[model samples]
Target chain A: MISVSMTVNGKAVSAKIDPRTLLVQFLRENLLLTGTHVGCDTSQCGACVVHVDGKAIKSCTTLAATCDGASVVTIEGLAHDGVLHPMQEAFRENHGLQCGFCTPGMIMSAIDIVNRKGHDLDEHTIREELEGNICRCTGYHNIVKSVAAGAHAMAGSK
Target chain B: MYAFAYQRPTTVRQVQSALGKHEDAKILAGGQTLLPTMKQRLASPSAVIDLGHVAGLSGIEKKGRNIVIGAMARHAEVATSEVVREAIPALAALAGGIGDPAVRNRGTIGGSVANNDPSADYPAALLALGATIVTNKRKIAADDFFQGMFTTALEEGEIITKVSFPVPAKAAYVKFPNPASRYAMVGVFVSKKGSDVKVAVTGASNEGVFRAAGLEAALKGKFNPKAVEGVAVDGSNFIADIHGSADYRANLVSVMTKRAVTKALGK
Candidate 1:
């Protein structure tokens, strides 16, 4: 077992974990931060998307030990003072989810897109940027709309 | 993933020591491919050496006439790097189109080039640009570095430190990507350095990424899309899978080469 420490959602956390432990497994099982989903265990699915050191990466394929000393933010970290993040509110307002399994990852990835591409995201940009994310429900049409709205909302909130 | 001993080494010497200490040890650089392969149990090494803590192995700078990128430099960095964008915009654009934003954030140029996945985009860029692969032991030319499919000339325990790409006078890459995986089905990278012209093809070859001598000859004669339109590519040596047939890939090679030439010419 290896001792790993990292800041999760702004709190410092440390644990002794197996070398084989993935970041998603560490987040969901160890810390019980199940807000990050594992829709596809492979790296192709974006359901395991989370911010590590200010960039979005797939947690399922990321080893917890590799993330030592890094800062990770998940869907749980999006809200502040019991108020939903603008992106989260935009998803709810836009009806961006159906089964909701892919919601957390979608919202996280959307925020990442905003952070990189800015808040004025277009449909083509959102759709193109979401290539890593796979929505099995085939609800990409609404997902695109939510990301656009969320991008603008995030800008406004800032 | 199998149970293994993990070590985070901060220096090249430490990494070499770790490799020497453990049998069947694997160097982990970015985990974009290694972790997924391990999870599938396709690769189960006894020791996994993580290079995240390694210093002096992550940066991009213009050294002389070449762009030197550290082995640990992530794809996102290469794509967004002003130096890379200004020096060889084709390289930066190729980096930008790799995988996706999340994958780019974690994937590294060294990892991609070292792994030499046939469908990967960088190998084509390296081959066409005549990039140099700088290892801890020696520097290998791109032509000599890539051996075959998922194969490279890198010796065991010899880690890649950086890749140096000579800026081409004109260059562009055009890929016909597989719809599902976004991997290049038939990608062509075309470049011109003075009177010499190089055309590298990826994804469609059975032997992995390779230089297209016929297309190169055609381009050398006339650096235009029309020059490659007349050259016929053989499909027997190409990969034939459900994604595309050998004949279909052959056609794509022709079309992609033409398109790549046009893009390189900025037409």
Candidate 2:
């Protein structure tokens, strides 16, 4: 077992885990941060996506030990002071989800896209950037809208 | 994933020591490909060496006429780097199109090239640009670097430090990606440096990524898509998966080459 420590949603957390423990398994099992889903553990489905140092990544394929000193943000960390993050709000307003299994990862990935690509995201760019994320429901029409609204709202929130 | 000893070594020498200490060890650069394979139980190393803490292993900058990228530099860094964008927009675009936003954040150029997945994007760029693979042991040309599918000339314990890509006068990579997995089905990278031209194909060959001598000969000095229009590409050696037939991939090699040449010419 390896002792790993990381700041999760602004809280310092540490755990003794198996050397091969994935970050998604660590987050969901060890810390009980079930907000991060594991739709497909093969890294194909982005249901386990989260922010590591403010960038979106597939937690299922990453080792928990590799994030020893990193800061991780999950869907649970999106809201602050009883207020939802703009992206979450936009998802609600735009109905970006259906079965909701892909919401957390979708929202996390959307916010990171806004962080990097900025607020003026076009439909084509959002669709292209969303290639890694798989949404089995909604056919991505609403998700595209949510990302656009979220990008614009995020720009204002910041 | 099976049990293994995890070690995060901060230096090249430490990594060497870790490898020397464990006979069955695997180096983890970006974990893009390795982790997936591990999760599937296709790879089970006794020791998984993490190179994340290694110094001077992740960055992008211009060194002389080449763009020097640290091996550990993430795909996002290369995709969004101003230096890479300015030096070779084709390379930047190529990086930007790999996997997706999340995958790009974690995947690294060194990992991609080292793994040499048949469908990977970087090998085509490396081959066409004549990039130099800089390892802890020595600097090797791209021509001598790739041996075959999922194989490289890198000896055991030889860690890739950085890669230096000579700025091409113009280049572009065009691929028909598998819609779901995003792995290239048949991709072509076309580049020209002075009077010499190089064209490399990925995702279509059974022998893995390879240079297209016929297309290269056609576009040598002309640097035009029309130059390769008449060239014949054989289909027998191309990969024939469910995504495409060998003939179709061979056809894509020609189609993608033409498109790549047109993009390289900025048309």
Model number with the top TM-score: 1
Model 2 chain B weakest lDDT span, ten residues long: B221-230
- Candidate 1 lDDT over B61-148, as tens digits, reads 9999999999999999999999999999999999999998999999999999999998899999999999999989999999999999
Give me the runs in candidate 2 sitting further than 4 Å from their true place: none
Off by over 4 Å in 1: none
Question: Tens digit of lDDT per residue, candidate 2, span A37-101?
Answer: 99888888899999999999999989999999999999999899999999999999999999999
Computed on C-alpha atoms, the DockQ of candidate 2 is: 0.92
Error of 2 at A61 (Å): 0.9
TM-score of the A chain in candidate 1?
0.98
Q: Chain B TM-score for each model?
A: 0.99, 0.98
The positional error of residue B85 in candidate 2, measured at the CA in angstroms, is: 0.7
Taking all chains together, the TM-score of candidate 1 against the true structure is: 0.99
